[model samples]
Target: MGKLAQLSGPVGLLLTAALTGTVGFLPQPAAAQSLLQQEGTLAPMQDTYSFEGEADQTLTITLTSSEFDPVLSLLDPDGEEIARNDDYASVLDSTIIITLPETGSYTVVATSFSGEGGSYAVEVHPTTEYEQVFDRAVQLFNSEDYTDSVEAFTAAIALDDSQPSVYLGRANAYLGAAYLALGENFAGPQSLEPEVRDAIATDYEQAAALLKEQGKPDLAASLEEQAQIFRLVEPEPAPLRPAEPPEEPANSQS
Candidate 1:
């Protein structure tokens, strides 16, 4: 199993979905299609819209109103608040980018920031291109193309750095590359360049930090231990050469 597959179940789903390139384009029943381009007036109060969303799917929800400052809130299937934003896009408008954690009913509340409602438009769309890149990264890593895997993981990170699993994948790719540089047994510390060593250490450290921030301290600890195994070992200094005898004043001696 690849390093990504070793992550917690929730995180494992993310990779599984990505590996299948099924984020934005997952097949769904006609009745469960995502909500799109809905507009109405909020009659001086909150207006809520409920819709079905798929797991590991990225959704872009945009709210625009001219009369009042718009506020948007997202709720999961259990009514747990996912995120809320006000004026994230422009004046009197709110935009939310959400990565759904599961496939179920979700609620979106659109209201005025000051509770003074007015005409508002809501648009929901999918953003899944990055997931494809993430999938490619996994494939490269599994294929043992460590250098290319690093690049692919980097591309995925550039698209979405919020995913802690991607950081773990990148860290492992860096470690793999470091081992490749050190030869078959990865024991040639003297031959390992400082930059290569630092790259490995830095990636693993980043992964650990991200994992900790994402509430996976145990996983972070495990990664930190792995990182220590590849810690840079400075090359021994060369023995000092014997000092050459001072040249006699040839002209004076002659």
Candidate 2:
């Protein structure tokens, strides 16, 4: 069974109730509110919500369900898709953090990843500066803009160094930047600059140490394994030699 199917908690109970038709009528779309939490059942149709946001304000939207993987989308006042997410971190829940581009009513779409029906909860609220920066860094990493992602993750760390995810994010960004520098015809680790390679290793070590301190030894061990990649040394390739001319045919051929 999938992880979502294996969920055992309040969410699982809610899903069971939904599947058994025990849940009440679906709630109406939420009105514009500074902080809102709405519960509803997705019966193959997406639930839409509205929220008022100011330009430059950071908004955090989260969708959680146990019956199916959740998908969240943010649409601007003009109905343009501003941001979307299928999963937050490695979980089935979805989250989208974005800074409002203009002051207007925004729409939030709550749906399942595979159109499966289940009970779900949606939350919309303003987030802190640190979350804003950290989320931006994650978006940059997803887009493969590693250099900028590193800068954004560093800024997030500056805002709050308590988050282990930020450190891990910066480590991945550093590693990505190193690989990007090597390009398609990469010659392995030897082709990366010492400083660049060292940065990747250092960030991973830092993240692992932080994870260990947070009692996440398993995740820390994983990070340690990832860090070892930068320490690998690829053996030098053997030089190419010119092909020798073919030997003359034997006399028997004549």
Top TM-score model: 2
Candidate 2 per-residue lDDT, tens place, 16-52, comes to 1121211111111122233556678888878888877
Predict model 2's lDDT versus the native. Answer: 0.68
Q: Which ten residues in a row have the lowest lDDT in candidate 2?
A: 21-30
Against the true structure, candidate 1 reaches a TM-score of: 0.40
Query: How far off is residue 253 in model 2, in Å?
Result: 68
**Model 2 lDDT, residue 45, Cα:** 70
Candidate 1 lDDT over 190-252, as tens digits, reads 356777666666666776786677676766676676566557534457999999999887575
Q: Name the runs in model 2 displaced over 4 angstroms.
A: 1-34, 37-56, 64-68, 75-83, 87-93, 99-107, 116-121, 187-191, 233-254
Q: On a 0 to 1 TM-score scale, where does candidate 2 land against the true structure? A: 0.60
Instruction: Report the C-alpha displacement of residue 103, candidate 1, in angstroms.
Output: 20
Candidate 1 regions with alpha-carbon error over 4 angstroms: 1-127, 188-191, 232-254
lDDT of candidates 1 onward, in order? 0.62, 0.68
